[model samples]
Target: MPVQRIFFGWPVPAMPPRRIAVLLGSIALFAVITLVFTLPNSIPSGPSLGRFTDHKISLPKLPKTFSSPSILSPFRVAAHPPPVLKNTTSGDSKWYSNWNWLSPFSSSVTLDENRSLLPPLNERPPIYTYYDHTQKKAADLKAADNALLLTWRRAWWAQGFQPIILSPAEALNNPLYAELQTLELDSTLKVELSRWLAWENMGTGILCNYLVFPMGAQEDHLLSFLRRGKYPKLTRFENLGHGIFVGSKAEITAAVKTALDNPELKTAKDFISTVPKETFQVDPHHESVAYYDPVVVKNKYPKIDEAISKGANGLEILNKLIISHLHGTWRNRFSKGIAVLKPEPDHMSAAIEPAFTLAEFLAQCPESPMPSSCPPNRPKCSPCMASTPLKISTPPTYRNTSELYTIGTVPHPFTMAVLSSFRDNIDVPWIRRESSRDPWITALTKEVSGTGVSSAPRIIKFKEAVASEHGTFHTLWLTAEKEVPQDLDWRFGFTIPRNATDTGKSETPVPGPERRPQPKPDPKNGPVANPDDVKKERELLKRAKDFGQARTPAEEKLRGAIEAWNLADTEAWRFARAFLARSRVERLKWEEEEKHYVGGAGAERGKSSGWGRWFDD
Candidate 1:
């Protein structure tokens, strides 16, 4: 009755209960089949209840024939000691211990039995001495003076001139003598006399010698010579006490004319005019050479006209004039202060006679002609005839052989003399005798060799016997040609070994401080294992595990190799974890893409399906 009366909603249908049950059963069957085919076999249904438990209980049984080491035996139970190790053996004690043979002894020993076998330690040093040649003839003068005076007289006579000697005291007191002195005759005396005698005349010629007359007497002699109108050759034109000589009146007059004619000479004449007549009279009779008074001359003639006229250009002229005046003034002052201690005639004669004769003969002879005294058979004088004349195109240039000899040898001569003087004074016996193997000489030899000087002299080698006797060792000497620069002060230092004796053996070892111990290396910071070793270890472990047993050395090495393999595995696991982590991140991105694509496809399918339904209707 209810079915006849019932009204259903749109799209609903009524069915029997049996038909509904069959439909539900068919749906359940379909779902079971789909799940069976789609699910993965690897996925476990639940927790592994007893799978690993069974494996743990079923250990492989040993065969009856196998004989394992007893568990209680020391061999089976023994374990490698902890990795920490101790170095008890002396061989492994310290790195330096390996060289213990070189260690220093605790105490020095004196073995009397082998005293002769060992070399001696104490030795003597080398010595050097020097000598001077310039002062060799200083002890004799009278003979020189006499010879000089005679030569002067003869030269004057040959030139038709006469010389007059005067007392300075008389000259100063007498107006006539004073007038004569006022003419600068005394100042220009040497030059005037030399010129009058035509003695290789040159401008402002200079003559040098040791002094023998008082300054005042020299002045008086010069004045008298000037008044005589005749020239005389100078005995000894040397620095001594007061004034220089004119030697003749003709020389004086000629000098005056020369000064008056040349403005430059006028200055010099004016300077000479200022000298006090009385100043030239002091120690009037004293037999000693004297110096000129530059102060008096400057006071009398304060102008530099002579300097200007002489073409004294730049600093050179100024220096020359100043030096000349300073020297003259110094000599005059020195003479005034000197005590009038008369020298013996014999002493003077001994020092000067021979030199004076040689000088006079050399001066008078025309430098070109050979002397008759020369060997008769020779075509030219062997010693007198020089290979070439001395020439100096430049101011500082030197050409005379004698001058060169003097320049090269003079300084060293004095130094040598000083050194020689010290010989007896020094206490060391080694210092008295010159040693050929001296360090200074050796150094000098090395230095000369390095200089590449083509003509440098070779150093003399010492005799072995002499060196052995003196215990002298070869050394280097550094001798410089000129003063060293302040900036290069290091060059002044000479290298000297601590031990100077040769000892006929190798050099002694230099002592040094004790060495410190080196620290041991840290394992963590030790050198990394070789990559090939790591790879080989890995391959060995893999082969052992694959075979299920160790067979060879390579396979047996896998006992501890698993730990190394674990390290590599850890590295690979880290890489896999990173890859998986990155994949999860990409999965999220893919899910988002799927959502978008699915949403779009769903919308399109709905529209298409609806249109098809519409067309079918």
Candidate 2:
């Protein structure tokens, strides 16, 4: 019988030790197998690929103005009230209401009405003007109304200025505005304190000469005339006329501060006297009507020298002769002046209407499928319009004058549009063409866009002023030379000095700042490497490594673009040189072939006529 173990109370058999050992061995084998499979996954591999890899890299914080971040900056942006569509009394809609459906992008949308669709980087500069509803004088009110209307028409519609019309109340919201309300002003004068405060708050260096439009008088030629001259501090009339004041954002803000701080100044001339003498230059073509004209004199005007003043800041003197004969002379040129007088009519309507439909504007845009290469045809884009209007269609006239070759518009409009819609602070490259100038050094004293040149300090100041309005200055380069200058302060923006082959090495140093002091020879180590030289080498190696070993998909794509841009720039010159070389070689080969054929023909003729063989021999 088999040995049996009693379950609860009986005797047990003791012959199973070998079987128990086998079972235990089997359990151990299974545990070992599980550990082999699971331990590799559970344990951290290495710092480069394990826990460290899981941590996301933190990019450096971008500048406040860099890449137009939509961070609601403390700096003020000029605002425009939405245009009223319906006429309260007539019950008829304005002309643009019907035009909403005629939009180029989509049938239901108007481009300007939806600011979301406008190009993100390079926006048109705002031209600030204002009117006071509480004015007691008819002439002052009418003058303000008329000046604002014509100014809007020419500045917005004709010249592409973004017009901003602020109210007296809007300006008074600033504590500084109330300080200005006490100064004396002429009955015909409309003080531009509102405009000054708005401009000061705008925190940009964009041209603010259009402020003159609302103050003295509006002229059809005034805006265009101002554009032709260097930014003038004051528009001089023949007889110390202080009717019109014009200047840059700096000049205007300074003058406004002077006027506000000085309460003793009475007349426009006194206020003008406080401004710097550098601003007091003669400009006969300034052409605004005389401040002491008969119409102005009849409106309770005082003698040129009075001691008491009453408006907000002495800025009331800014437009002592707000309306001139030009207002009546050119009144019908823009519009009937009826829409302007209406309290509800939209000032911005004329800007986006009849001159060119929003559809036409969109069609000519660089993002369009087939946009015109002409700068004038395309809507004003800062990056594309950096150079003068003349230089866009052709290369610069002078040799080595340097030209910024724009890569036209990138074709991925949908991606750009989406990104812009989200207001992402990403650096979207505006230009990717080979520059004859290195941009880094040129931007120090001259505009890379070829606007003009100035002292390095002044240029830097201007850049700082405008950087908030425009984005931070940056450039992408595929150098025509072997290396980028090591001396330029690369701290300004991103710089990737790459070659066509991507060899990640640079030989010849491009022209740059003076060499820094070289390291002294060491007794033991021979010589220490120059910091700049080492830095440059490290940069090249680092950039190459980063480019090749892009850890993520986004980085990989960005590197790909870098590669493409460099290749495109280099290939442009390479192909051009290759074409020229091949053409010359082909031409020589053709000439030789022709000579041989002629000789053979002559020999045949000699064989026939008996003189060809003698000539050949």
Give candidate 1 regions above 4 Å deviation. 1-170, 175-245, 248-400, 403-617
- Model 1: per-residue lDDT, tens digit, 498-557? 111222344335552224333343332222333354454334333323333324564334
CA lDDT, every prediction?
Answer: 0.26, 0.33
Residue-pair clashes per prediction, in order, are: 43, 12
Among the numbered candidates, top lDDT falls to 2
For residues 25-65, could you state the per-residue lDDT of candidate 2 as single tens digits? 99999999999999889987656453556577768997867
- Considering summed lDDT, which 10 consecutive residues are worst modelled in model 2? 336-345
- Superposed Cα deviation of residue 469, candidate 1 (Å): 41
Candidate whose TM-score is highest: 2
